[model samples]
Each structure stands twice: as structure tokens, then as C-alpha cells.
Target: MHPQDSPSNRPTPVSADTREANRRQDHFGSREAIWLFGYGSLIWKADFAYRARRPALIEGYARRFWQGSHDHRGTPEAPGRVATLIHQPGSRCLGMAYLIGPEVLAPLDLREKNGYLRERVTLHFLDNDLADNDQPDVDDPLDDDGLTTARTAEGLVYIAGDANPAYLGDASDDSIAEQIAHAHGPSGPNSDYLLHLADALHAMGGEDDHVFGLATALRRRMRQAATHPATTD
Candidate 1:
């Protein structure tokens, strides 16, 4: 367990207004089910129960580790980095999508309370499989070329704004890896998050350059640490 895992290091409480804002902005009108796009920790540590899970792709965004984690992955003094989607034209992020019940809203909302805002996005499922029998069938939107587009569904994702206090903005891969390798919080070492995401992407026969590059640098740093243990006072 990491030092930040202590109860005292738990994340700050979510404001009532934030909760209400999420509820009000949710565009899942009268729908019995909701789709959620998971690009990072949700890939492996999705503690929340869900009905269906499938490979999905979202365009117009790139996964970046610019968000700072103060509770789950790090502390107030040295926050760990976490992945957040950044708007980038022509970029597509491959992730998983979950079909979940509405009751999950509150818990999900609180879990991502730190510097994250729930935003709606369109997900294109790679597989045609629909885990739920009652899920609605919607026509895929066509592009200008008149080609059949991937099956699409509207979903909510947690994204941190550049203006968020926890935002780290931009940094070199080595810099980010150094921070991740040394940071530990309630959840675990920050490097574990980066490596896990890279492994997940590899298993799916996909690649994310930014995540993989950081993971590579982090592994090298870990090797160095193992070879030269810190001296005791």
C-alpha cells in the first residue's frame, strides 16, 4: 500500500453543486441504461459493477497524463499523474465502454470527484456485441463519403480542464515518468497506472505512444532504483 492510502489522505469531499451539475448536464434522457467510456484506471480497476463491456473508440481526443491525483494515487504535497482526455483533432482514443445502470451515477461521480468534470462523448464500439438485450438499436452516423460508420453510443467521461488547479499542463516524457516513478498514494504507485494502461493497450493489439513512452521511461527508472537502493541514515 502507498503512503497516501491512509484514511487521512482520502480525497476531498464532492460538493452538492457538483453532484447537481452532473445530474443536470447528463444527456441520457429517459434512457434505462447509460454508457461510460473508460480510458485509464477504468481499464483494469473498474470497481463499479456493469452489465456489458466492449472495445470502443472515441475520436477528437487524445489520452494525456496531465491530470494530478491528490487522493487515490498521490498526496497534496506530491500528487501523482493520471490520464485525462485532451481535445486533439484527428486523434482517436481506444478504450472500453460499459453499459451500466443509472444507480451508478452517485458512486461514479464521487470516485472521480478530484478535478474531474463529467462530460458527454460519442463512443464507437468496435465490436457489434451488445451485452444487454433491452439496449436500443440506433443507426450509425455516416461521414461525408457515405461509408458506414462504426456503431456509436453517447456516453459520459470524466475530464479535467486545463484550468483545474490539479492540472499539470504539458511536460516531457522523461519528466512525467520521473514524477510517476516516485509518487505513491492510497491507490498505489503512479508508475503502476502507466504500465497497466500500456499493457492493456498492447493486449488489445493497439498502441498509445504517449502512454507507452512514459511506461518505458518509468521502467528504466525502476531498474535504476533496484540496482542502487537508497542509503539509510
Candidate 2:
């Protein structure tokens, strides 16, 4: 179901006045803020032109590139694989923190529909003066508190899936690579997701070594395919 159709993500069925008030409150001002933690696609395709993307981390969630679903990502002919966050104890995953206007939530919610759910997480900007001072040049290391260590929010943010029976949390690198490469889009395969991510990370000059690690892995994988077409895909 679309995020708007999902009762959990929507405002309650209430009086018109109450609903209006709720909408007003949810409508964040230009400076009014919310933090979106991006680990996967959002890391690069954060369509929201954020006021500022601060380097911060939230604890408790470990990103596993395992989630598998035939409905949205895969097809009967060429099954695709994607990434989803998993609850892993005593562990941390690297990600980016986006402080954006509330207006962007609508599309973000919609993009993460069907199986995914949203849970709000409160992430601290490594620098309290978030926008002031020099923006960390791409790749500048900012400390992160994994899913367990960071503060959790009562409000909701979109999640990949919510207790989704179809959710599968583990997929092989080759599987993900093939899916990313083979993904059919009006313009191209979902491979652009990976390619853009590499480009974005490179553009941002991410100081985090982990992002570099994945970027390096993807580069090598793509190079391998280029060198030996028959072996790839």
C-alpha cells in the first residue's frame, strides 16, 4: 500500500479542525528541521535539498544488504536484490544524517511504501552549530552512534519494511551487483542507483573509510565486468 494509504503513517481519522491543526504542526518551516538518516539509496538520492546535511550517526540499526522481494525490486525473470536495515546487537553501521524541511517527508514516505515502515530517530549533529562553521568537506569523518547507541525518536521516519514477511535480510555481493546492474528502468537499469551512489560519495568527498570501501568494491566489480564481459552478468 502507498504511504498515504497506510493507516500507521497517516494522521488519525479525526475532526476537520484537529486534522488541520495536525497538518500545520507537521508542516515544518524553512528553518524548522527534521533529521533523516540515510544508509542505502537515500544516502545518495536524497531528493530533498536539505538545509544542511550534517555528519552524525544513530545507533541500533546495522545495515545489511540482504533484503529480497520479487514484488518491487525483482521480477520472475531476473530476480533483484536490495539493502535493508537489520537489528544487530553490539554493532554499528556508517550512514549520513540529513536535516531537511518537513515537506520532503511526503515523497520520502511514498518512495518507501508497500513493505517499508517509518520510525523516527533523533540524531545529534556532530556540530551543534550545524550550519555554521565550514561544512565538512566530503568524506570528513563524523562520529556515529549505531542503532543501539544513538537516541531514538517517538515520531516516525520511513523504513524499508515493517515486520514484512517478504523481507529477507541477506544477499550475496554478486547477487546485489547483478540486480543493481540489471534493474530495468524507463531510462536504465537500477544499476544507476549503485553508480550514482558511487558518484555522490565521490562528489561529497566522504571522509568515512567505510563509504570508500563500498565505493572501491563497486568500482572493482564494475572494472572486472568491463575487462571480461562474458564473466559478468
Candidate 3:
């Protein structure tokens, strides 16, 4: 764990809008097409076009529901939590990487404009046999050492760091679940996002304790809410 990423080493909140700064980054070099990583809603909801996609992982990061969503998943008055990567040395985060043309960045930037800044990362592809295109079984045990990486590609990923204004920071699992269960925005109920990501991770043969924990807590809260509805005065 890097000292900068320590749970208590949170930075001061800055501007939430990061579209312009992301556009200024010139890490793509001369490549006509580049890879983009999607660890959250992008895993299940691929609204944009992509040439190809594969299960991939990045090092030194772990997914957590610390970022607050005011535009898509919740309102300004009561924001919903969203997933973001926090540096955890030796930890690997599994996600999907899409091969896309450079032109795709414009719309992607807009969609993830809420505190998400484009970060250059090295994507380690999981499947060695990309030519076959056979999906990996979700039930199989994840053998990181036994797995052969087809290749590694430089890619861009959206990360909402602590500097962002919408960052909600760390919270207890029960507290995070409470916010997600009752929050709603244009995309829909915040619980839907949590549940969908849980399901997506299962389908992708990825195990995230934080995500699964929140999903379990959210389900329990939902059940209680269903059984004991608040009556109007």
C-alpha cells in the first residue's frame, strides 16, 4: 500500500469536471486505436462501439465504491456512490478492456465527465487464446500464476481520485449500502448499479470482496424496506 493511497491520506477536494484535462493528455502517441478499461457500468452497459474486448487486469489498484455520482446515479442534494480505483500495491483489479478508435474518446469523455479523469494504465489480458474467442468459465478457479497473458497493451481508464469534489471517500459497508439503496438518478435506482456490477463481476469470473459485500448489504436493506415500508403521515 502506497502511503499516498493509505485509507487516511485523502487529498483535498478539487474541481469535479475533468473533461478538458483528460483531453490534453497525449499518452496515446501515434496509435490509431487504443484500449479503454471499464470496471464499473461500462462492463455491463457498453453504450459505445468497440472493435474488440477482453477480460483484463491492472496492478496496484482495487475497486471501491467511494466516488459520488451526482449526474448519472444521484442528484446533487443526495449523491449516489460509484466505483473508483484506489492504489493498493500488489492488488490486481479485473475489468474489461475495449479496443476503440481515437474518435471514441469524445463521447466517452462526456459520459464519464463526472470527476472521472482518463488515466494511462497497462492492461494485462487474461485469455491467451484470443483467436479462439471462447469465453472463460465463471466457475473455474482463478489461477493468476497459471494463467498466460496474451499480451499487454497501454490503455486509458477513468479514475475518480480523492481530489474530485464528488468523491464520497471511505464509508462502512452498512452505511454505503444505506445510501445506495435509497438513492436514485437519471440512470435509475443506485441499487441497480450495485447489483448489476456484482452480477457482472460474477459473470466475468472476478471476485471483489468490497463489491460483493456491498451487494449483500444492499439486498438485506432492500428486503427490510420491502417488509417494513414507511407510512405517510
RMSD of each: 6.6, 10.8, 8.2
Cα lDDT, all candidates: 0.76, 0.49, 0.81
Which rank order by lDDT, best down to worst?
3, 1, 2
| Candidate 3 residue pairs in clash (backbone atoms < 3 Å) | none
Lowest lDDT block of 10, candidate 2: 12-21
lDDT of 2 by residue, 1-233 (tens): 53223222222211111222233344344434556777667776666666455555556766554444343444433433445676666555445677555677666654554345556565644444443343433442222312222344222344555345434444345545544455443334555555665566565454433334444666677798799886545
Using all chains and alpha carbons, the TM-scores for the candidates as numbered come to: 0.82, 0.59, 0.85
**How large an RMSD does model 3 have?**
8.2
Report the alpha-carbon TM-score of model 2 versus the true structure. 0.59
Using TM-score, give the best candidate's number.
Answer: 3
Residue lDDT tens for model 1, 4-115 = 4533223433231245556666556676567789999998778997756778889999999988787777777777889999999999999988877688888887777777
Better of 1 and 2 by TM-score: 1
Model 3 lDDT per residue over 18-83, tens place: 889888987657665677989999998889977567789999999999998877877776678889
